[model samples]
Target chain A: MKVAFPYFGYDTIALKNFLEMLGAEVVLPPLPTERTLSLGTKYSPELICLPFKITLGNFIEALEAGADTLFMAAGARKCRFGYYHFIQETILKQIDNNVDFYPISQYTPFEFIFQKMPKIFSVSPARVMKSINFLLAHSRLIENFRKLVRQARVIDFTLASIHEKHALEIIADAINLMQIRKARKEIKALFNFADDLPENIIKVGLVGEIYLMLEPFANHDIEKELGKMGVLVLNNRSLYRHIKHLLHIDFDRIKLNHRAYKYLKESPGGEALNTVGEARTFIKNGVDGIIHIFPFTCMPENIALEALQKMSDDYSVPILSLSIDEHTSKIGLLTRLEAFIDILKRVKNQKAVSRVPRSSLLTPH
Target chain B: MIKIGIPRALFYFRYGEFWQHFFRNLGYEIVVSPSTNKQILEQGLKYVSSEICLPVKIICGHIEVLKNQVDAIFLPRFVELNHGLYTCPKMIGIVDIAQIQVGNACEILSPKIKDNFMLAHFQTGLKLTGNPIKVIKALNRAIPYLSHHKKLSNSEDHKQRILLLSHFYNLWDDFIGKDIINSFQSCGFDIATKEDLPDKVLKSDKGFAKNIRWVYERELYNAFQYYSDKVAGICNIISFGCGPDSLIGEIMSKQANEYKTPFLQLIIDEHTSKTGINTRIEAFSEIINRNYQSKPYLTK
Candidate 1:
């Protein structure tokens, strides 16, 4: 059976390789574009979030590319994400009657690992575990590459673009755990120049809905744009961490939820609590600001916006919230980012001026 | 007597009776905010985030009206109504939203509702009365009313029947759902709601749409499946930006069409005009009558 999954930045390459190791022909959709957005927008429910529309576009493209089996994540608690696969399957069936759909639940590792994976791949349980291990290793390489790229972009945009292409190529080519480790080392060494390029860049934490955080097209390339503006983007919700959280393999996930209790006492059933935790974490780490993003009409993350605003007030850090939909204009987004960065800089400068010694005061003392 | 306020929106329409019964049993005077109106909506708009659905904004408005008049306002955080399926996050987060919006005017008695609603309710009762014995007595008085309170069977024998698909709150709220129901009745049609069906039937295994995880939404979909043959048409009234309604309304429409039933999905927002809703309801009733007249054999 030919398998296809929605593109979530470079992490899709890791998922594609993992599926191929299970002996399935993987069909990757063409990089999402305006046409894909329109295609999804044309048929998707008018009020559904952006990720739903874009992923619907991904499924349609994958179907057109002769992929019969579609894999989508489902069952994120207290969020509409749990129902996306069911609705998308119905809509896709309306488009093509013969296609296969699987809505993998993010919360259930036992079902996904032992029951769903082995049944679909016709592989042993041990083999599925090994594949998961390799996938995790592979995802870490991509995560490390993202860290370097964040720095490289702030230092040298042209070099960062070149490095990004090479990094994705490395992830795509790496088949084994050893190769994955080697790629990680190479990606880190390639961007070592960025490590020493001064600590003057404004540090901003990126946190929000997982899909919007990972997918550039969904979030208007916020991280890339911020990096180009000479900002250090510290995104804690990398794909490696996300996969770990889904598999219940990460210890930090529970602690992150606990940390968010000050702002949000209960889990709103998505990464909303995580977003709150990350904002607190970023503030403690001396970050200049927090930039939160989520698809418009998103349930969980919309809840996070209010908490973030409250946290910003209590912590004395500025926050820039961008709610993206199909109608979110690039120009409007750029204007907001420019204004936010200016505000962060002004705040930073004011603090710097306040710390000056009495002898160094510009005024007649 | 301690004055306990309940917002006459969202849970108020669904469980206002239960809260009123419980608070009154505990000897606290229960004050329900007036039904949603222009001033309440405007007050809610002043305090709440603009992106939140109208129900939540209206709930906030209700709180605004009650904040000064009562000592404590009851706002329960509904995390999960069923074991797996959950209510909308806005409902769970409303307590937090209201606390911020309404400020410290009244004590927002919000108990986190998990599986043990009795313990939660008892604790909520204890907030008003110091004695645990009194809380138990109040809960005992409240539980039976909640359980034994029956829905009067609509069992309309009229030839033309329509399944009114919506939450009880939306269906009864004077501003929105009440008019749509009146329009159907005024047009000489029988309307059956999701509440009329047995809980067992509404919660029965949803054949293909098992992923519909909202508790009330599950009932709405399963009720439609059960009553699609019994009814002549399906009319769903949902507020805009409602996560479940926005998502499931399409599926509801699709199922209605597949079952060869006339379907009308009326979307309402704060800005929705009365004339538009009236026009849609009128047009929908006319089609149902026409279809029933054309095929006399299909009438239940």
Candidate 2:
């Protein structure tokens, strides 16, 4: 059976590899563009979050590409994300009657690995486990690539873009564990420009809903834009960290929650707690500013905004919160980014200027 | 006597009476915020970010009304009322928001009700009274009122009955819901809400709708499923920017189409004018009446 799933940023490579390893011919929907977004927005509920619309568009495109089965992730508590598949399936049925929709429940890893995967692909449990292991390794490789690209782009945007393309090719071509292990070193060597990096670089923490955090199309490539502005964008959310969270092995998450406790005492159920935690940590680590991004009408992040506001006042850090929807214009986004970067530069320079002794200022000619 | 304030928005429509009884039994005078008004809505709008749903903003308004008048605001963080079912994320974090918004004004008695609802309440009670026996007596006295279900008018008796689907807050709140209900009533139709249905009716399992994780939204889906055929039409009232209602509204509309039932969705917010709602309600009611007359058998 030819299977299709929504594109999840660069992590789509890992999921595609996993499905292919299970012996199902995977149909990758074209990268989300204006057409995909418009198609999704047309079919989607007017007020649903951005991820649902984009993913719906992805499914519509994939179905047109002759894929008969669709796999969408599901089961996030207290978030609308868990219920996306049920509604999407109903909408898709009106469009195409023959397509099969499988909601991959994110929380139930055992059921997913042992029962669902094996039954769908007619593969053994051992094969499913092996494929999952490969998926984790591949996700880690992609995560590392994202970090290196963010740093490399700050140094030299054009060269970093070229390296990013080549590294992605290496990641996509690696099918086995051995190839993945080799690709990691090769990708690292390609971005080895740490020695050339200047000190006292502008650092900005990027925190928000995981989908908008990872998806460049959704957030209008905010990281790349920030990198182009010569700011080091520190984004901690990735498929690897997300997988670790699901597996209950993310130790950093506990620390984050504790750090966030002063601002937000309890998790408002989405990544709101994480956003607050990560933002606070970034502030403590002396990041110049924080950028909070989420879909418009996103409940958890909106709540997190309040906490972040309080944290910003306490820590004296500037925060730029952007709520994105289909109507969000690239020009508008770029203007805001430019303005925020300008403010961060001013703040950083003022601090640097204030550090000099009064005698040195008096002798400055 | 110490006064406890209860905001007359959100879960107040569902559990307001129980809280009143529970607090009264503990010898504390209860103060419920006045019905939502323009001033309260504006007050809420000022304090919260513009992205929060109307119900939350209105609740914030209600809290603003009570902050100075009462000693403490009884805003419970409703996490999970049933097994495997959760409240909306906004509801879970509202208490924290209130704490940050109006912490210095008054004390917020927020009992987080997770899996063990009674224990949470009891702990909150113990914290207040420090008398376990008195807390148990108050709990026992107030427990029965928790499930005070409203009786649904018989659909067979009324020729033009419409199943009104919405959260309790939106349905019962005078300012937000009164106009829609009045418009329907003036149109000569009886309304049946989820509250009118028996608990057993709402709890009965349906196919995929049973998988809905949000407690109130699942109730709405179940109510729509049960009453779609039993009523002349379905009118769903939802606040603008409600995260859960966005999806639930879509699902219910699709189901209504399949069942050949007339469905109307009214999206309300702080800026929704009464005249706008009345005009839409008039058109909707007229359609429902006409459909009932022409295709009476179709409803069945």
Candidate 3:
């Protein structure tokens, strides 16, 4: 069976490997482009969030590449994400009648491992467990690669870009757990510029909707742009953490909710609580600033923006919120980023100047 | 007597009468904000981000109107209404928004409605009355008023009938939806809404209906499933920027296409003009009439 799924930034390699291990010929969709966004926009409902449009575009591109089966993640609550597969499937069937659609629910891991995955691949549950283990290890490796890239980019963008390309190839080639472990060490050595990094570089917490956080295309490569500006972007959302969250083994979830309890008591269902929690934590840790990004019509994140505003007020932190959609211009986004970074730099410098003694300031060389 | 203010928007349309009765029975003066107006809409817009849906903006405006005049605002955080069925995320977070906006101006009596609706209401009642017995008595007195089983007017009198699919707030609110309802009625068409249908019709565990987990959205989907073949056409009134309606509207229109029934989606926002809605309603009625004339035997 020819299987296809949407592109999720660099972590697509992990999902592609997971599907391939199940003995299915996985057809990877071409990386998202202007053509993909336009195609998705042409067919999607006018007001649906950007992720839906992008994923729908991915499915269409995959179908063009001879994929007969489509797998999409589903079953989230209090967000439009859970209902994405139902609408996307209906729209897709009109384009191709012979395609098979399967919505892999995010919450039901047991059914996915024992029932759905085994039934679809005609494999034993034991094989499914092994594939899942491979997926987790691969995703963890990718997460580390992202951290190294984020750090190295702030030091040397050109050299980091070159290493990023080489590291991604290494991550994709590693199949077994031993290779994955060895690849992690190689990736770490490849980005070892710890001595070149400054002590007090400008750091900004990136918090928002998970899709916008993980998918660089959706956010117009904000992390790379920030790195180019000599700023460190700390993003905590990744497939590794997301999978841990779904399995209910994420220990940090309680602490996040506890930190966010003062501003937001209950989860509005998406990552709003997480966004608030992460922003508050970032502020407490003395980050220079915070950047909040989400789709234009996102309900939960918009609500989170309100709480973040209150938190920003109480903590005296500067926050820049970007509401992205198809209409958002790259030039405008960069201009806003530049202005926000300038403000953050000024704020950091002012605090530094205030901390030093007046005698030390007069004795500056 | 301590006065309790209830904004006449969102859930107020669904349970406004019950809340009024319950609060009055508990010996508190209940003050409901006036229906949505331009002033209220502008006030709501002032305090919120621009991307929020129109209904939420209007509710925020209503709260602004009643904040100073009352002792506390009765804004309940509706999390879940049925088992595994959640309200819209905005509905769940709106109480917090109201709290942030209305700060020390007024106290917000927000009871989180999760599994047991009666228990939440009783708790909110006790906050005002200070007596468990009085809260229970008031709840018992107002239980019957909570059932909003509205009957559709006789469908035989009109030559065409349209299923007016919309949430309770959008349909009943005079400023947001009254124009379209009036325009449809004036065009010699009878209208049926989700409120007119009984719980059995709305709770049908059919194909796509079973997948919908939002309580009100499920009702819209099931109503569309039931009336897709029976009605002459379907007109869905959704506020701009609503996350759930964006998907549900697409699903309904796709199904309406398969059923060969005419479909019209009217997107309303704070900037939506009255004449614009009336004009669209006029054009939609014409299309439905043409379809009816072409295939008289298809629709009953």
Candidate 4:
């Protein structure tokens, strides 16, 4: 059976590798574009979040591309992400497109391992484990590529842009764990500064919905734009971290929980808690500003926005919260980014006179 | 008696009776905010973020009304009602929203309940009163009042039935949904609520429908699924900016089509007019009647 999944930056490469190893022909969904967004928008409920619409568009395109089996993450709890496959499947059925929809429950690893994966792929547990490990190792490479690119973009935009292409190529060609490790080193070396950076550069922490954090196309390539504007962007969200979270191997969540405790007591679903935690952490690290981005009408992130606004006032930090949808204008986004950067620059310049002592900014709150 | 403020919003509909009894048992006087009014709406608009739902906005108004008149506001942060089933993120973080809105005007008796529903509540109860024995006595005395909620089946066997699916806060609230519900009732339709369905019914096999995570949404889905064939039509009542209902409303609309039942999705907000709601209900009611008239044999 030809299987397909939604495109989520370089995570798609790792997923493609995993499915290919399972002996199934993998048909990648077309890259999310205006066409995909429009198609999804046309079919989706008017108020649904942007990720659902784009992912629906991905499924429609993937189905059109002759893939009879569509795989989407499933389980309806915590956030709306779990129930997306269900809503999208109904939409697809309305258009009379038929496909075997399999929702992989990311929450239930044990059930997925011994039963779900073996039954669906007709593969043994060992093969599934190896495929997952391969994906994890490859994701680490992808994460490294992103970190290197983040720094490289700020230091040298041309080198970062050129290296991103080479890194994507490197990730796509690496199928096994060992090959992924080798690719990681090569990819890292391509953009790795391996040195201390200049002190005057504005440091910005990017936090929000995970999809918006990882997928550049969804957020109109905000990272590249920031890099072009000469700001060093720090983003911790990635598929690799998500994979580690699923395995309960990531301790970042614990640290985030501890850090965000003063501001937000619980995970309000999605990455809202993470956003708040990182915002606090960012403040302590003396980041010039924090940029909170999420899909329009995203409940979790919207809830976090309240705390974010309060944090900005209480902590004397500048935060720009942008809600994106199909109607989000590129010009408007760019203008806001330019204005935000201008404000951050002004704020940085005046920090010496500002009441927030520089010494306290370095220490954790 | 220390007058405790209870916003006539959110879980006030779900657990209003119990809360009133619980607090009253401990010798504290309960002061409930008046139904949604113009002043509350305008006051709430000033404090709450615009992205939140109409119910939350109105609730914020209610809290604003109670800020000064009462001793403390009772806002519980509900994490989960079921395993893997969550209240919307909006509901989970409402304490923070209310806190922001009220500021230092009054003490907010906001209890954080992550899990273990009763114990968390009991802890809140103890916090209300230093004496554990008084809290235990109050809880035991309040249990009967909480259990007093019994949804009786509508006795209209001949009238056309329309399933009204909404969060309790929306449907039960007079200011929010009273107009639509009263109009439908006046129009002579038997309205079936999600509350009418037992909780276990939601967890049953729903065939190929996607696993709905939100507790209230899942219950609404099951109620819609269970009643689509049984009812004449379905009316999904949602606040204009509700995130969960926006998705579930679409699913319900689709499911209604499979059953060939007339479905009306009514979005209520600050801007929704009584006339507009009346016209839609009239149109929907007419369609339901015509639907039954077109197939008299199916009615029985």
- In order, what lDDT does every prediction score? 0.84, 0.89, 0.90, 0.83
lDDT of 1 by residue, A270-297 (tens): 7888999988888998999999988887
Candidate 1 CAPRI assessment class: medium
Q: Candidate 2: lDDT of A1?
A: 81
Per-residue lDDT over B144-218 for candidate 3, one digit per residue giving the tens place of the 0 to 100 score: 989954344655654677899999888988788788888898888888788877888997768877888888999
| Ranking of all candidate structures by their DockQ, best first | 3, 2, 4, 1
Q: TM-scores of the first chain across all predictions?
A: 0.97, 0.98, 0.98, 0.94
TM-score of 1: 0.95
CA error at residue B274 for candidate 4, angstroms: 2.0
Q: Worst lDDT window (10 residues) for model 2 chain A? A: A193-202
Q: Which stretches of candidate 1 lie over 4 Å from their true place?
A: A362-365, B147-159, B297-300
Please provide, for model 4 over B1-300, each residue's C-alpha lDDT reduced to its tens digit, 9 standing for 90 to 100: 689999998888878888898998888999999888778888888777777788888888899889999989998888876664688888887787777767789998878665566677689888778889988898888877764443535665777778888888888778877888888988988778877777678655476433666777877878888887888888988887788898889877877787788999888888889999999999998998888888675453
Which 10-residue span in candidate 1 chain B carries the lowest summed lDDT? B147-156
Whole-model lDDT for model 4 versus the true structure?
0.83
lDDT of 3 by residue, A1-365 (tens): 89999989888999999888899999988889988999999999999999998999999999999999999999958899999998888889989999999999999999998999999999999999999889999999999999889999999999999999999999999989999999999999999984377978999999999989988899999999999999999988899888889888888988998998887768898899899999988988889999999999899998998999988888899999999998898999999999999999999899988998999878959
TM-score for each prediction?
0.95, 0.96, 0.97, 0.92
Off by over 4 Å in 3: A359-365, B149-156, B297-300
lDDT of 4 at B280: 93
* TM-score, structure 3 vs. true: 0.97
Better of 1 and 2 by TM-score: 2
